[model samples]
Structures are given as C-alpha cells and as structure tokens.
Target: MNDIDAWVWWLVGAAALGIPLVVTAMPEFGMFAVGAVAGAIVAGLGFGAVAQVLVFIVVSVALIAVVRPIAARHSAQRPQLATGVDALRGKQAVVLERVDGSGGRIKLAGEIWSARALDSDRTYEVGQAVDVVEIEGATAIVI
Candidate 1:
C-alpha cells in the first residue's frame, strides 16, 4: 500500500490494541499500542515497511523491558499512608471500660472499638492508655 495508507493502517492497529488494554487493564497492550504509534510515525516519515516494523519491535521491547519492572515494583510496594484497620495498629488508645482477656472497650482513632488484652493475664482500667497490636475481625487486640 501507499505510505499514507500504511500509516493510517498502523494508527488503526494502535487503536485496536488500545481496546484490549482498556478491557483487560494490562499495561503490555498499551505499550504495544504506543509502539504501533511509533510505527505509524515512521511510516508517515516515508520509511520502508521493514524500517517501520523494526521501529515498532524495538520500541515495544524497550518499553516492556524498562517500564514493566518499574511498574511491577511500584505495584508490589506497600502504600505510604495506612488506612482502615491497618491505621489502628501501633496507635495508642484510651480504655473506655475495664479491658481484660475476655473483652472491653476502647476509644481508638476517635472511635469506640471492642478491645481485649494481648497478654491474657494483663488488664487495663478505664482511662488507661493501651497500644493497639492487631485487629481480629471487629475486635482490637491491645497491650
């Protein structure tokens, strides 16, 4: 096909690749779509079919090699700001009622939470400060 037609086809292929990327939420497809745009640019510049294909392959492979690992590392990392129950761990709370091995109540993060002592033999009296160690279901384990 003519150079203009070839470039148009490459752009169409890029759009096609984007569909699956959006549907599957896979970054690889988006990378390939970008490569297709690179091929379209080469074709619009009047490069031969072989050169266009080579640019597409090189760009796609480079993106996958470099960006993929960075993306994976970012996804594997823990969030800097803890939320929900995780935010409660390691925080000090005031006992609202006497806390023992069986059950009690505490004001944690400004909310009343069901609490129990981390050490079964230990106990906390009202207004005493305790550290939240963990959350099991709706209950907070404290010490």
Candidate 2:
C-alpha cells in the first residue's frame, strides 16, 4: 500500500505476538487488547483497516499452528503421583515385622510404613516375600 513502510514490519510482528501473550494472561479483555494492538500497527504503518484485520488473522493462525502439537502432546502424557508409595504399587516388599492386621509396619523402598495383610490368615514373617496390593495414606496393604 502507499502508506505502508517495511521498517515497521518488525513492530507489526511484535504486536501480533504480544496480543496473544496478553490474551493468554488476561482472557476477559483479549478481544479488545487484540483489536487495540492491530489498530496501533495499522495506524503506525499508515495502512488501511484491512491491515488491522490481517494482523488479527495472521496472529491467530500462527498461534494455533505453532501451539497445537505441543498442546496435544501435553494432553496425551500420563501424570505420575510424586509420592514414593505410588511408585511401589504392585512391587514386591519384604516384611520387616509380622503384620499386626490392625496396623503393622513394613520396609519398602528403604522406607518403613504401616501395613496390612491382603488375606486374614496370611502370616508374613520377617524377611518373607510380599507383594504390595494397595497403598492407603501412610500404609501399604500386601499379599
């Protein structure tokens, strides 16, 4: 266009990026903010209103194309609980003390915790093999 200057192209690109960053941070006024940035770029470039519209369109398309794949990967990833017990679920542990049934303790992952027998009659001896069936609070239920 007659009024557009190439030197302001960098400013136009910055406005395009900044609008969405501000929008992500404060979504309520996202549309207004985008419009204002687009308007600034168009006026600064001494261009027509069509340039204002193009700023918004190009910014939105570029944002979606760049962020869509990352978003998809984040959504598909599994979450792991940070607790150590969750890491030991279904893993074998050696009983350090005969499970008292009401509340007993076991040594697992170099840590001691309250434990319960999976079967009522099952007697876990010291150094005997046991599989962690469930973890509840600070206790592990084993078989």
Candidate 3:
C-alpha cells in the first residue's frame, strides 16, 4: 500500500489495540483516546497523508508474522502422530507362523508382517488366539 494507506493502517491498529487496553486498564485514561486522535491529526499534517498508511502496514506485517506460527502450531497439534507402526495400529491379521516370545510372522490383509509376543510365548499355536500388541519398524509384536 502507498504511504497514506500505510499510515491509516497504523492508526487503525493503534486505536483498536489501544482502546481495549486503555478501557480495561485505568478507565480514567480517557486522555489516551483523546491523545490518539490528536496524535493522528498531528501526524497526518506533519508526515503528510502517507505516514499513517505506512505505519499501519508495518504494524499489520509484524502482527501477522508473530501470530501465523502460533496458529499453525495449534492446528498442527490437532493431528500429529499416526496410529501405530507408522500405519497399522489395531488392525487384524492372520498368523503366518507360530509366534513365541522371540518372533514370528503375521499375515495381515495380503501382506506378511513380522511379529512376536508382548510378554511370553509359552504356548501359541500356529493358528490360535492372538492380538496385535505393537508394531515396531517393519514388524508387529503380537500376543
């Protein structure tokens, strides 16, 4: 924006931010509002029509720069990490091999995944009751 527009922008920002702060802060500083108007007037005459416009633009830019990241961070927190194993969390899969405490294979969907028991694999038949405990790297720990 041109200097005139920028100066006006600065004026608006100052007024908006100042009004709320002043009204809540002292309530007696009615002088602040009057001073703002007077300052705008004096600034307009001394700096020409362009000063307010330039100030406004600068204030707007600074505000935007400061607030943008906070907004993005708030949004980012909404959805950050995936389910599990980077993809599959509580998904069902067939037992490709008898899982012991060590490791075995689970056939989930059409893909085969390595798996192991969460605790102990004392007696786990090739085809028996099992649950996907956790997924690590390219493997799924099962029980």
Best by TM-score: 1
Better of 1 and 2 by TM-score: 1
Candidate 2, 113-136: lDDT as tens digits? 789987777778888878898998
Any runs in candidate 2 off by more than 4 Å, and if so which? 1-10, 22-70, 80-82
Candidate 3, overall lDDT? 0.62
Model 1's alpha-carbon lDDT is 0.96
What's the count of clashing pairs in each model shown? 0, 0, 14
Q: In model 3, what is the error at residue 32, expressed in angstroms?
A: 25
Ranking by TM-score: 1, 2, 3
Overall lDDT per candidate, in order of appearance: 0.96, 0.69, 0.62
Per-residue error at 22 for model 3, in Å?
36
| lDDT of candidate 3 at residue 17, scale 0 to 100 | 60
Residue 82 in model 1: lDDT: 95
Per-residue lDDT of model 3, residues 32-129, tens digit only = 44334444654656675455445445544554566556766886785566754645666667777887778788886468878887777364667675
Q: How large is the C-alpha RMSD of every model relative to the true structure?
A: 2.2, 5.8, 11.7
